[model samples]
Target: MKRINEQKGFTLTEILIVLVVAGILLSLILPNVLQAIERGNVTAHQSNLNTINVALFMCYTQERDWTQCADITDLTDGNFLEEVPENPFGGGYDIEDSPDVAAGDINAGKVACSTVEVTVGGDTLPGTCSGA
Candidate 1:
């Protein structure tokens, strides 16, 4: 049989050292990766808001009434949006249409996320969208 020094496997000390190095590297890198992902999600959320506003605008141009496109299907029927995007946090978009023109909120269609307050990077994004 070969001598113990001739064996071709790592020693316990060497394996422990490797594990320690890997743990240190992950500790340094994991937070940055997670932050980048959160930033991307926030960015996507903002884009979705813009898209909803644009779709509402298109629907209003067709229906001539902001309240007419109260539902996502209403906008989809007019090809305003191909498909509704899923909110990154959770739930779908909330579309609110103002029908009462006399209330001083005429033709104001707003789209917002279910999660009312979305805070990213310690700043709040515009949580609602309007046709105008």
Candidate 2:
């Protein structure tokens, strides 16, 4: 009796080669995607900080005074802010009355701004929101 010789499925070596290729492709693609996501998060964080700063600045304008803001609630309670934006990295958003630099102080300088900070990936990044 004559038997037909036909490949029924992929060989073990072929499967391993395909897996290796897939792994290489994934290795090349994953980092860029992750980086893009991280950049997006950072941008969103900055936008939120800017929004908070603007609201605080407007509040200061309404009060016609320059005071350090410790909490975002003051803006909300005063109706300057409808709500506080949530941090993307599961860290609390902080507002400081003074900036890290002498030039960033709203009270001292013409800059109407605040020092905002948040922790991202266990790293604390500070940003300044200025009225100018």
Candidate 3:
């Protein structure tokens, strides 16, 4: 049987093929996009940590004692940093010293973003920071 003036449109197989290709492309690209976003977050996290470290340096120069400044508030209160910067994953950066960690460790004297660890080679260290 034949129909007159049949509409011209994509067949089911063609539509499905197009959808499959789109899905494949999306699958290939989505992870890369997500990874790039995470990388940006990691970079921002490092920048924030560096900022806090600079503030810590200022605190150390003024107080002349690491024990004197053991919290982010110590930096903020002392006018070293205008405000506290939160970790990218959430929560605030920590200032750790003393008996909790041994000397020469990253978090020992000064380490920010204690939650986010970055592994370079075999060493796993927290995200370093930079501040204004």
Tell me, what's the RMSD of every candidate? 6.2, 4.6, 7.6
TM-score for each of the candidates: 0.72, 0.71, 0.66
Q: What tens digits encode model 2's per-residue C-alpha lDDT throughout 16-70? A: 9999999999999999999999999888878887898788779877876555344
Q: Which segments of model 2 are wrong by more than 4 Å?
A: 4-7, 67-70, 99-132
Descending-TM-score candidate ranking: 1, 2, 3
Angstrom error at residue 8, model 3:
4.3
Q: How does candidate 1 fare on TM-score? A: 0.72
Worst 10 residues of 3 by lDDT: 112-121
Worst 10 residues of 2 by lDDT: 97-106
TM-score (C-alpha, index-matched) for candidate 3:
0.66
Q: Rate the local accuracy (lDDT) of all candidates.
A: 0.70, 0.73, 0.73
User: Which should have the higher lDDT, number 1 or number 3?
Assistant: 3
lDDT (C-alpha) at residue 7 in model 1: 60
